[model samples]
Target: MKNVLRIIGAILGIVLAVYLVYQLRTIFVYIILAVVLSLLGRPLMNLLGKIRIKNFRLPNSLSALIVLIVMILFVVGIFSLFVPLIAQQARIVSSIEANEVARAFAEPLNRFSQFLADYELTEERFDEHYFRAQIRDILKFGKVSSVFQSIFGVLGNLFIAIFSVLFMGFFFLRDGMLLQRILETLVPDAEVPHVRVILDNTKRLLTRYCFGLVIQVALVTLIISVSLKFFLGIENALIIGFMAGLLNLIPYLGPVMGAILGVIIVMLTNLDLNFYSELLPKSGWILVIFACMQLFDNMITQPVLFANVVNAHPLEIFIVISVAGTLYGITGMIIAIPSYTVLRIIAKELFSQYKVVSSLTRNL
Candidate 1:
């Protein structure tokens, strides 16, 4: 009868899990952002606690406040330096016709046309009209005007994200113990220790993942900004470099997107691309920025993870990112690593409970 009850409970749990995932999809983004923010803030919160900065050993809310202020100032500083340049570039781009710009900048397309003509390729089979229409459609769909609108839309999302993070971080930092105790009250006394272990593992993994990424991202941004100033000039460097660095947080798609932005900025500005004509086709300068970021992330970021945090397999990490991007696009990509860390902890626990699997994974 005990075994029968356990079987029934297991089946019920599976059904409940599927239902919960379907229902919780929308709220998942908010929960993830909150979790990431709280994790990033935890180390500073701990430092404050250790320093006895609170009133008579009581918790201080000021640590979270200070972190928030620093983050805002950092963002503001970057914006102040670059927004005007980007705006001027935008005006220049807006004043140009597509055909005129293409004449001025579409050398790649001209080369392709030359290749096709030289090869005596069947123009009819290529359906140049159809291709042109498709190109026009894509251009319309992804126009600079639409991109500017999307940027403004993201500003609203940024505010919502910030508000949610602060609200969640404050409570997590101040009253997380109380919340855990409440959760503990709901669990069976005998199983509470096991549950506590799970929660602690989750907290530690998330904290390391978030805090490490924050430092990593900040370092990458600083490196790109400095490199851009040295190589590209400060006229449009800060904003472009910062945007690229921030997007680099998204993984595979980021560097390419950033390079495109760099190219667009170069096209819009009065900078003398002719001087670097030899280096232009190779995109050596943009490549340098990406190479530096990749080097820093691999040499600096991954080594720190290996030294301190759990060492996830590269293939496992890739699959997690692919799955995450498929499900939630950019946001999913950002959250995928920490989410995998949480899953890895759970998987280890479940595997350890089964003798056969334990033997198989023990060597891992």
Candidate 2:
């Protein structure tokens, strides 16, 4: 009877937990972001804690505050540097007449349309009207004002999200063990050791992985930006570089997309009658630079990040990302590796008796 009651209680507890999570999904997202930021800033916080002020060590709270301030300043500084450029680009894009853009691409697009018509894929020749209509439909250009309004709306929300994340992150950094204590109290006594192991491993692995990612993104951005500015002489190099680096969060497909975006930006901003003669060569050079960056990333940065920091096999990581991407699209792919790492750690701690879990998590 007691065992039956305990089983029922566990089921009820799980259902209640799920319901609460559903109700507080937005707050949960904030908390998750806070936790990640806390993990990323943990090393800095620890370093600050170690600093002695004459004969006094820095308190955890003060250390966390300093780290938070530094993080905020770093974020604000990057935005301050890039936001003007992005705004300039946005203005350029908005100022570009749709008809002019269509006219610029008219020749090549007509060739494509002719090919399709010849192949019986389409019954009509493509003209600027058709092209412009397609672009408008695809980009919702008819609602340009609304789109800008939505962007402003998102900016407002972003400010709120940043504040909430920082507020929660401060607590997480200062009282880093609070979550563990709560978990210890909530978990079954028999499973407390397993939970502790899981949490500890999670913190270590995730902190290293998050920090490694920051380094990887920054390196990629710098390499691309410098190469574009110095070699290709591309205007808006910083924006293109940052966009490429940010897109690289998607794993296998990201670098390719980034390269393509670089080419598009070059074409869009440098449209001229000499597109074939001069711009084409510049575009090729841009591709080459991106290719070199990708090569460096795959060869050097990735190996260290995966093997040394995350401790996952390359093949395993690839398969996990591919599966997640297939099942849930880009967002899934973005999260796949870290999610898999967490799962692997937990499985290793909780189900070490299982052969597959034990084998897969042997390194962890």
Best by TM-score: 2
Model 2 ranges off by over 4 Å: 1-25, 53-57, 135-142, 313-315, 326-329
Maximum-lDDT candidate:
2
Taken over the whole model, the C-alpha lDDT of each candidate is 0.66, 0.84
Evaluate model 2: give its lDDT.
Answer: 0.84
Query: Model 2, range 1-364, lDDT digits (tens) per residue?
Result: 9867865885697589758966896797688789899988888987887788789998888889999999989988988988899889988876776677788888778878888988999788786678888776756645767888999999999999989999999999998897788789988899898888889888888887887788888999999999999887778899998998899988989999999998887887876646567877898998899889988998899888766545777798889998989876897798788878888887787667768889898888
Candidate 1 lDDT (Cα, whole model)? Answer: 0.66
In model 1, state the lDDT of residue 254. 77
User: What is the Cα root-mean-square deviation between model 2 and the actual structure?
Assistant: 3.5
In candidate 1, how many Å is residue 106 off? 5.1
After superposing candidate 1 on the true structure, give the runs of residues whose Cα lies further than 4 Å from its correct spot: 1-15, 50-85, 95-100, 106-108, 117-158, 231-235, 270-282, 355-364
Give the TM-score of each candidate: 0.77, 0.87
